[model samples]
Target chain A: MKALVWHGKEDIRYDTVSDPAIEHPRDAIIKVTSCAICGSDLHLFHNLVPAMLPGDIMGHETMGEVVEVGSDAKGSLKKGDRVVIPFTIQCGECDQCRRGNFSVCERTNRKKALGDKAFGHATAGLFGYTHLTGGYPGGQAEYLRVPFADTTHIKVPGGIDDEKLLFLSDIQPGDTVAVWGCGPVGQMTIRSAILLGAEQVIAIDHLPERLSMAAAAGAITIDFMQESVVDRLNALTDGKGPHKCIDAVGTESHVDFGQPDTVLDRAKQMLMAENDRPHVLREMIYVCRPGGVISIIGVYLGLVDKIPMGQAMNKGLTFRMAQAHVPRWTGDLLRRIEDGQIDPSFVITHKVDLSKGPEMYATFRDKADGCVKVMLQP
Target chain B: MPLTNVTGVARSEGDPRVQRKGPSSLTGPDRLARALGWFSVGLGLAELAAPGRLARALGLDDKEGLIRAYGARELASAVPTLSIDKPIGLAARIGGDALDLATLAPALHRDNPKRHNAAIAAALVAGITLLDIAAFKGVKAAHRRDGGAARDYSDRSGLPRGAAASRGLARKDFDIPPDYRAEGTVADAIPALPS
Candidate 1:
């Protein structure tokens, strides 16, 4: 099978790898139909997140048809079922899953010890993520072996495409979302917010093309390069800020301001003095309303320096963050797509074969050629 | 060891034949302790693999060897926590936490170049140590409740024949079909279905 393999910092290769087979009773084999390069993938591409060995398969966002199912998986999933695989692998029977905190499912993370050591707790296994989570082979390949298939993958109904349902795992309805970073996830978040009945959506980014795309999705776009984000958001929300602030940009957030802290963060990041540049997180804290929910879908690996916790606590803010629990939202999102509530394909600016993964990763990471999202057809 | 003839059937938690051992399988604190055990292992490996990188990230690059040594200690602490069924391993972790704090005390000084980063790292370690203590207390309470008879099953073999043998039960084996069912015609079948 042809797949994207991670070699090192800024290096991804399209290589032929062995086809995946069902290794567990709850596993299923899927023939991938569509996959997308995620912004979080750039973290791996740049070698920011540790534990990524050479030849680890890369990619998480995917939809496909089930070609095989283990006996235990037959109870819920069947061969020939079209499904959307979530990034987080969950065993629905775990205590966390029962409580709807599927992203931290206790049973799925094979490298639980490592995850616990790094993050204070083991995260649920994530596809294509490094060994911090279980090093599950990713979906950016011709075929994928999905573990905990009965509970992890959502069955998409007929007459709906993968693009329309892909973003359902990230966004929810009734959220006044303020998204930072107008990348692929940011754009989809904009569309998903609107579809989910968010009264107002604020999209922040420096890129003209991405802001324009956000505007097209009925969001109020803020160019961080041109204006002060905190001021704009305050003025727009009558000094209360949005109800929910989404950090779509993760650890590698670009800082448009020349503030000393921002400069230090960037310099430290460059010199490997720090693993993350949390400019967006700080801005979100400054811009979020009192009692607002800060939802972080962004991928942050290590400890961040100097977050404004005092202000967050004094203002009574709620912080919720995790790798998206894809299955939790996939079923409903698929239904929404089938009902014509959203068309997620609008975010795709580049569509190429699996062989172009290497070049496309660079293009996407650099935000070159107005590329917002790249869809890889394997 | 196989104690029943039913090979493929999923074992229910309520099954009386299966003896409950180790940490309470479903309690919040037990789960947390297990997770902490894993975390210690993971962090230890990272420290051992690239002490220089870990030092740099923590703004203590000058103490690379110390970081590597701490990683070794972490790995040592993690094994007992992960492998042992007793609360003693968690207690050891609390001791390890104190050592870490003492090691990090120098980095907290105002004169340190990366004092802010070091402080953050220390705060994180402190928070984890608190969790370790909480988990330790929970495990201790559970241990007392179980009358200190919670057998350490960590060293048990692939099959548990001793318990069944003591009860005069004969082990039975049965053939179970592998779960995977492959369908080569899925793509063709999908296209043939009516939209």
Candidate 2:
């Protein structure tokens, strides 16, 4: 089967990799119908992200049909059912999963999710990456092998639009991260403050499109390049600051907050002084109202640039951080999507076949095209 | 607590009798961690294979757990007079083959069509007897680590059931030492699903 494979530095290509099949009674093999490139994939393009090397399958946001199933999962799903799959492969009955933290399951991402020795490096995940993960292989190919078939898959409603459901994997949850970062979670820390239900959701970004999408999602848009986000959010909310303040832009933003090292060419790589790190997170802390919770989903490698712990404590703020339990949110989110409360697919600006992703990757890496999301067809 | 099947609220449909067995003598961490480890390995592969069924089955549990663990008990006990709904689909037959997902996948798919699934299907996966409404209510603030004064949380707002929840904590709000702490922190309720 042909899949979009990521070779060494900046080299993404479409090649015929071994096809995927159900090898376990608990497994289900899905034929790829639709997949997309995530913002994080750009990390691979820029060589900033490190994990699986060349020949690794890249795309994660995906939806497809069941071609085959192992014995145990057969009764729960059968041939020909469309489904939305999450990035974090998890078992439904684990302790962490019981608490709804499936992403950190001891068996999935052997090294990171459970730690190397816990599940053993090889005990974890899918295609493309090295054997460190189960290396069972991943979706970005003609077929994807899904483990824990009964617990990890989401049956896509039989007749909904595929385009709308594609983002269920990581993007929507990431978007939810942004929403929470700026909304309800933010409100948790800032008491009596307006919430994400605020009339204006302040989408902060240098790009017009993300800002536009944020506005489309009912937020007031703030282009950091054009206006002072702090000033604008305050103005929009009557000096109380945005009901919720989300940082979708993360450490990549120019003059990025919490980035402590200035010596590097750009994008504060090294971090020694906590305060020297850009002040955005802290600023968001300040921008938050008293008692507001801060919703964070940004990819901060380790400790944040500088967390305004003092103010957080002073204001009774709480910080909720996690990549997202997409499976956990699937049902409710699907309902919301069906109900028309949210339409995240509008974020997709580019769609390409597996072969075309290389150019998209290069362009996305150099910040070439205005690509919010690139959906790849196998 | 071990939950037993007893007469839940006899609804318009029908009620099932579930007996409260005892506090769920749930497994300890080590045991749970091992089970999770094995399940994670197996489930991850299932996801790569049968993500649709995988997601559906997962939702079924959490939904059921949420319902049985919270709603069932609350509903059944609150309105023992109400009737319960009948179980169908894979639910029709319980206590057999563990309703194994791998095996169930074929049936569920055979049951539906159209590119994996494009429909919403929910079922009553488990029975409930005692869902403490109070337990679902969020009442955290264990940070009083050093005997610092425990903040009075008996009057928080913006929560669906905050006032009611806070009212319960008012009595003990001051009793807890500032530093007196509890275990893990949890949300009172699932946030209104992300829009």
**Per-residue alpha-carbon lDDT of candidate 1 for residues B162-182, written as tens digits (9 for 90 to 100):** 212212111011111122111
Please provide, for model 2 over B86-144, each residue's C-alpha lDDT reduced to its tens digit, 9 standing for 90 to 100. 11111212222133323334434544443133222212222210111111121111111
Of the true interface contacts, what fraction does each candidate have? 0.00, 0.00
- Worst 10-residue lDDT window, candidate 1 chain A: A167-176
Which sections of candidate 1 miss by over 4 Å? A168-176, A256-260, B1-195
Q: Which ten residues in a row have the lowest lDDT in candidate 2 chain B?
A: B80-89
The CAPRI category of model 2 is incorrect
- Top TM-score prediction, candidate number: 1
Tens-digit per-residue lDDT, A113-170, candidate 1: 7678767988899888777787777888888889899888877777766666655562
lDDT of each: 0.71, 0.46
- How much is the lDDT of residue B57 in candidate 1? 65
Question: Isolated chain A: TM-score per model?
Answer: 0.93, 0.81
Q: What does DockQ come to for candidate 2? A: 0.01
CAPRI-style class, candidate 1 = incorrect
What are the TM values for chain B, all candidates? 0.60, 0.17
